[model samples]
Target: MSERSFRQTPHTSHDGSNSSRLSILLFIFIFIVLCLLARLVYLQVIKGPEFSQAAADSRTLSVNISPHRGTIYDRNGNVLATSVDAMTIYANPKEIEDVSSAAEAVASALGGDADEYAELLKQDTTFVYLKRKADMDAAEALKSEGIVGIYYIEDTKRVYPYGKVAGQVLGFVNVDDEGVSGLELYYDDILKGTPGKLVVQQGGGGIPIPGGTEVDEPAVDGQDIVVSIDIDMQSYLEKRLAEGVSTIEGEDGRAVLMDASTGELLAIASTPYFDPSNPSDSEVGSDSLKTVTQAYEPGSTFKTASMMAMLEAGVVTPDTTIFAPAELSADEYVITDAHERGDMTMTARYVIQDSSNIGTSLLVENYLGFRPLYDKIVSYGLNGQTGIDYPGEAAGYLSPDVDTWPLITKYNVTFGQGISTTPLQMARFYGALVNNGVACTPHFLISKPQIGETLQYDTEQIVENTAAIDPMISMLETVVEEGTGTGAAIDGYRVAGKTGTAEYVDEDTGVYAKSSYNLSFVGVLPDASTPLVCFVGVNEVPYERNTTEVFKDIMTEAISRYRVVQSD
Candidate 1:
């Protein structure tokens, strides 16, 4: 065979194999093209509505619709705290051109520093807050500038119309519209209403689409809260208490006035208080309320309890006589009267009138046994919280095992020296005394029944039981008439109360401070059947003067306000 013929045969066979391979490759390419075309058709037509809707949803932006917070009003219908319409300015940094120039223009309108806002506008984020709760006029002026990427959201800023009057009682809310302290924190749920939402379409580059499809859910405004605080009386009490603190050169002072008949708290004032409108500027310790929160030894004021217990237990009558000395050594502690006096026989009424510690110890140790006396004092709401509608109410500390009290504790507590009590607790106890043994729980909220609504809080609980208070009332009236509480007496009204001078322990050394005393006075006007109870306490003050002047001034104002008639 010729060589050319052999080479030609191999070449022809190779060409045939190559042709088959080309045909298969062409078929596979055509199949792939057909598959891709079918997929495109399916996406564009069969599932087009669903896919398009999903893509549109991805471009939509959701915004929170804030609700308007409630207004807080005092019992006299004075606005304490309310919300004002404001604006929140924001920017989409990505959409802004010339960040520096845009930031400056926005800052000029907002009345803010330009460099700070420029730094915010230089961010890579889609959104940044330029100013929160800006003035409405300022925000409107900025919007009128037609600056790109800047937007405004409607917001409500809390404002206190009566600045710093009841600041501690009416708490402040944070930037997020959350209550941080006082009544605001207590009624937060009722004040913060339900928030709604808004959804709107936006372009890929953070530009809002013109006439974009929007779904809106309107927000529900919060309900209004009316508290039982008498703004006028509250103001007066604050003024007097501040002056009293300054005059005594004391650490702090607190006062509470309550309607004895209904147990409605008229006023609760504390010195060194903070204005809730701008809580950021207030020091933490200054804002603390001492009336319901602080507890101290009640001193001679607790003698009323011992006297009452003796009368109730039949251990002694008003005329029952006891030998009282200047000093009586009981257990390891030596108990003494305010002033040195020779041993003399004194009635139970005289014992309280003179504020005699020795007489009180004799009555408790001999006449009224420890158990019976302790039980009687417990009945007066001494060792428990007064259930006031304020935050951080400390139930005055009392050892639970009063039935087995030590001799020193008994002797000290018999004259209000060892046991701790709050001004509120003492006021309630005295309220029970003046009300003839029926006293309601001290409360701040006056239950206002909205049409077809039930109140969230109840104000009717018997804090003190009906005991024979007529004799005690007469005895207390004698105290103000001729005893230690003369400074608390009104000209025409029959005032009943007791004076307290308690030595407090030094916080740093944990021992009794010779100079520091809590000078206090609690009084009640029992002229008519219904009484008005008032209590004032000054901390870390010398006992040169009692807190009777504050009580007198406050009660005089109260009598005029309530039109209290003078009794015989």
Candidate 2:
């Protein structure tokens, strides 16, 4: 055993142990560095955006400020619809510490289920509305609660001052103050203005920081609109039409009154009207503006168009006479008069006065043919929608392709038995007659471009000249004096109009109902000066007579409102 060998062995062992220890320490240091680098990448890249958004949401509160809706006014400056300040309750879900407790507080204040509100409070969104257009008292009470994460934003709520006076015309808004029907929907673009934004710097728990950075985009309020409806007249018509429907044993009633020359709708009424203030308090179909949306057969009221056709073609004069039997057989269908009558002779005036379907059919089928009558009606704006400032205006149906019509169709259309029309369209046609054969576009909004958007004034010559209206006017006067529309006569006023009784075509059967009938009357007051057309119709009327008296009541009120004087 040499001293050198012992020393070498101990050194080798000690050096090996030290080298192993150093290698292990270096490996551990490298592993820890790699792990830290990966954690850093995750925190800075993958989860960075999430954390940044959460922090931002807690540090700043951003909200949308609703703009004020435009006011709706009638022709007489009556407020039909308007807006008022309201509050919208919302929650900052990101800042809510206890979702259930916050939801319970909101529900108790707002009269809602706590579980339902809890679901909304637990949403992933930064902002959740507890209630839109909330009651002011309720909102104030909740504000006083000092609940964390609960906030409110100022908003606007729609109000109809007249309640149901012009519900179909004014319509109603949803909780968001958005129009959903009628003229409100038609002019929603002008009624609903641009929304603005508000950003407020906040501290922990979404609490507003005093004197913090605030950015606001001012809201642009909606422009006002003026329509032609007379609020007082509209109210009177509403009451009268409801009464008319009940008295006639009809399911519903509708009417339209307009300036004969200007085409401005003065009053529109429908039974079972919806309340614009409380939309839920309405019947199913009552929300619809039936005057423009629903259409039905016109019956003998359409004879005016045919009478014009005969006069325009020079086929008949007011004195021209025709002999009609009890029933005429054409196209294998028996055509009879509106009232049961034996063989009789009738002049043009008498035919109109009596509403003689057979006589009109004989004259049209034998003398003027159907083309002139069809063209005359289409020219008077009865063939399509009147282009009114209203939503859901239905275009009245007219049979096309004159050559394709059956022989009976020609005669039936002359008496209005086979034609369908709307009350608004009928009012428009009558307006043309009163305008001496010039059809003005029917509308509710008057042209006021300086204040808001409006359509251009337009007119069309329905006839070559005024010659075609002279004889027709004389006969229309005769109708109210002694004809079927005598009930529509207004004392001391020179009135002219026509009556209509049409069979309701059942949807299930696709044919005329045995007992149901649509009764209607259209009249014009002071046929010469400042004429106003009043048209009324009732659906599913069981009686033979139409709504002639309803027209009288409505016209009486209208004439009184306009201060119309007595005429010879």
lDDT of each: 0.81, 0.83
Model 1 agreement with the true structure over 15-43: per-residue lDDT tens digits: 88899999999999999999999999898
Cα-based RMSD of candidate 2: 6.8
Q: List the residue pairs that clash in candidate 2.
A: none
lDDT of 2: 0.83
- Residue 31 of candidate 1: its Cα lDDT? 96
Residue-level lDDT of model 2, residues 1-568, one tens digit each, is 6556434444334788899999999999999999999999899898899999888877887777788988889988888898888899887787788888888888888998999999998888666788988878889988988987777778888988888899988888777667899888888888888878878787765566667645478888887888999999998999999998998899888899898788888999777799988888788877789889887788888888888888888889988999888898878888877678789888999999988989988988878877777887787777788888788888878887778998888878898877788988888887887787777888887744446556566888876657868788789889989888888877777888999888778889988887778888987764545678888999887768679898999888887789766456
Candidate 1 accuracy as lDDT: 0.81
Flag regions of model 2 displaced more than 4 Å: 1-61, 93-105, 122-126, 200-215, 447-456, 566-568
**TM-score for each prediction?**
0.86, 0.86
- Tally clashes: model 1: 1
